[model samples]
Target: MSKPAAVAQAAAPAAPAFDVARVRADFPILSRQIHGKPLVYLDSAASSQRPLPVLRAVEHYETALHANVHRGVHSLSQWATEAYEHAREIVRRFLNARSTREIVFVRGTTEAINLVANSWGRDRLSAGDEILITHLEHHANIVPWQMVCAATGARLRAAPVRPNGELDLEAFRALLHPRTRLVAVAHVSNALGTILPVQEIVRLAHARGVPVLLDGAQAIAHEAVDVQALDCDFYAFSGHKVYAPTGIGVLYGRESLLDAMPPWQGGGDMILSVGIDSSTYNELPWKFEAGTPNISGAVGLGAALEYVEALGRRAIGAHEHSLLEVATERLAALPRLRLVGTAPAKAAVISFTIDGVHPHDIGTILDSEGVAIRTGHHCAMPIMELYGLAATARASFACYNSLEDIDRLLEGLRKVRELFA
Candidate 1:
């Protein structure tokens, strides 16, 4: 072979096919500077930055197809309704839910949880019944059930986490008793980035005749989710966490389960007929979705899912895992840095605290260095309490993140240490 041919052959298998540079280009904000330094956004677990396609999709909806969906017969209304329903179908495919009837759009994970807590819990739960969550759960998963417990006189039971930050699976399984009405857990822990064994959790709950709801706000972007394969009764995720707009999320429930549950909120769209007497509610999904939904946000979420599909989730997962390894190794080497979650299986998140420095102080220093990280309890205060930590500085990775971003984070941590010392 010629020299050029050999060189080309060797290089062909050297690089990954998924182009990180091209992916980064899709997000315009990645190019901007923060405090005169290039922005290193490591807070994707909180809310990912929107790509150009998602932005354009929202803009197109507002400009060309702005109408009240499902309530009008005009051409524009028809177009808007088509777009809105198409977005629901996209969510259905994204989660591999059985039908569009299973998909319910809500404000976000918080509202979705509230929907289940109010609708499902109100019916199935009774006094002394238990809801099983985990120490790794975000507040969205925790608080709704707490409110339900308070309202219905049911009790909330939390499974513990191991010292390494992984959920104690045996303990979780043991918690599944006949009195356990529902099992609500996060598929991925936002604060610790711990990937829980959700499939097993679902199976265990099902064996005990309890329905499981997997909170996928952090898991949706990191992996492919199949509700059928997991056999979860309910799953919820926020669009903003997956590079879509805020104020829109999805709740996927089994059609049988959703049909049995009453409406969480009564509003214009959720009702069928309202006379002087009682009113009839809408069908399965719409029965849960009240009032005017976040139509533009749903369109953007559909576009974001399409964008992720084009990128290929397996490739994105591999790239993100590689970044996590790089960040973990680099961050672990820093002096006086204590990593919070040391689970063997984790997503692209690192929460750490430097000795003699508060997490907020670390956050401020890193912010000054143009690296964005989440500081504090990260809405999982129970997990913090379990770990005996008030807060930790968290840096989460996404498809657009690079190893260079990790380097910048390391540099910022060094600066933090220097300032503290």
Candidate 2:
């Protein structure tokens, strides 16, 4: 599809009969009151609220099967190991990966990226090599590469972002030079909600024998990610962004690449044997997943993915796009409120600023009216620098949100205007 067409399709709404009320009923927290008013949560991009199924799954694991995995032959240990490994299989299926060996569990997206940088980048990157990225990247994507580059005498280069928040495709293509060792980028910008052209990026990078890593923290919750179809070397995402518990995430690496990379951490379960003179590491993913794994968190993540699957990702995307469109049109019509990151193809995140009001003030005022939104640079300081912005107030949506929630947001923003005026 043409870029514009793709953008339009991304912004397009799904079926109108998406029973959002029914979906809202699944989440227990949506009914709570904040400051004597109904809570209007618009901060899913930071961390999504967990659904009942995810909570129940974690509770069940903790109550019935709490034990360390992969070592003990006891029943609880075996059960916990089964649950943990089963979660790995679910993640493998979610990403359409070849096997569970390609799925490595970590604390979250940050640790996953660090694993690749330390294990893969440090091993292969030499002096004068280049690591190419985009200005649309979150700090998690940029800092790891910068650290690796600084250590290896490699240079870090970032492609420019258009004023509309879209990545500069031509500049990105040009930046993929012969010495470009890796291409790391956000699948969707958390700050701008820009949906990057990752397929083309992967193709371009692979054409020049460079591997690509997609930070899927923002994209995974809203879309169906088939790593094989994208053909990217590495895909990382955090669980908290997807209605799962925090401190749990997955790294889907191509088996060949993962096999060649050394262990990123050393501890129990990651080692096959230990000797005073020399030690041997475990195979495939276990080599990278050192220490005791987050068993209950993995269970919760599996349940969360199952919940998303049951609701249908496409349906959720359409519902969110509708919210985005309505919010954009309404916010744009208001005086002195300017929308930032008006990318054509975007996830359901809206970042904006008022002419005279600081984003923190906006957030604080909105909070008084029981509306919760993120206000800050959103950990994308480079993107903020690119736009000459200190911060923007961001309202991000998820499946449980509804048109009523958007109305609440508008009402809260009006209160902000009234207070400022």
Candidate 3:
């Protein structure tokens, strides 16, 4: 309920040489005490806390240059519009998008995927075609494609994962055929933290002339996402996952693909000309964004991206990786504890189950100890079913997380075991 840093401040560059300790200071929530002790946040996969720079960027835009973008003739409108459009270029650079026109802002990853599936899928898919997704998919990626498949009388099939929670590339290879119109998969698993073999998947899909939509909701913050290098037709991510506001997200698509797909919705900003009988659609980016857009959110997200870029990608990745290694070793040392999703390459997520306790109970006990972690299916239930489990206790990390946070989670686990005993 407590929003961090309500006061507006100027954006700060990540200290010249950037120290992890120094970076953590930007997050006020991280410094607060919880349960009479320091709070240990381990749920970045759910949503990350906004850094001071990102918060200030949003505040500055709202206070100094507040106006609707691309519609007004006043000076404030020009300033606001430039700032809004600048956010797109920022995202384009952040994601290594081929062009700024490829970046489409929406509510979040969920809406981004929905927009593509409904707009592109509806226009391109036919009854005999099929969409190939993996069991590792979150509901956002899985559901939208399913809706498209159902509407078009197309079929949906899941590429299975091995028991270790890694996608079976061999199985995924077999699923690729002429009818496989699209391959939708997560760049990183939300529950398992599996950094998927996306490039290989993309190469395979591209060989078959099939497009790929990558759900980068988890990967954007932790790993380097290069749409040009990955050659994915679409990449979607949420701002909240990257220390930005809840309602902002990005959909990066190839210029040709975007131009080919019709507008998802018809409204003020998404059209060229409107008439009683018919309406003409706008170009690439704008065609996807209808109505008054989340211009403030875009600025905040760009700031979040800038903050991360300044932090140095390698440093953040190394810091979180070290924390995950510590958490993994500590949790694995516990008797009767089973670690789920042991993919060789993983992000900061650590999902494990104690011998007899339910994941829900574990989550409750952890929260009581002021150590936050996600429990239950983690929105990938089919993946759970594949592993012969209903759910897992997940402790996901972010740049703000420290080694002590992992210890708190371990302490919380011990408490849960003690109470049940």
lDDT of 1 by residue, 334-368 (tens): 88988999999899988888889999999999999
Ranking by lDDT: 2, 1, 3
- In candidate 3, what are the lDDT values of residues 1-421, reduced to their tens digit? 1123222222465322225566678887888877777788888999999888888888899999989888889989999999999999999999998788899999999999999899889988899899999998898988898889889999999999988889999999998978999999999999899999999999999998999999999999999998999999999999999999999999999999999898888889998899999999888789988999998999999898888887767778877898888888989999889999999999999999988889899888888899888888998988988888999989899988876677778888889989987
Off by over 4 Å in 1: 1-11
| Residues 153-266, model 2: lDDT tens digits | 999999999999999999999988989999999999999999999999999999899999999999999977999999999999999999899999999999999999999888
Off by over 4 Å in 2: 1-15
TM-score, cand. 1: 0.96
Model 3's alpha-carbon lDDT is: 0.88
Between candidates 1 and 3, the lDDT winner? 1
Candidate 2 vs 3: which has more TM-score: 2
Q: What is the Cα-based TM-score of model 3?
A: 0.95
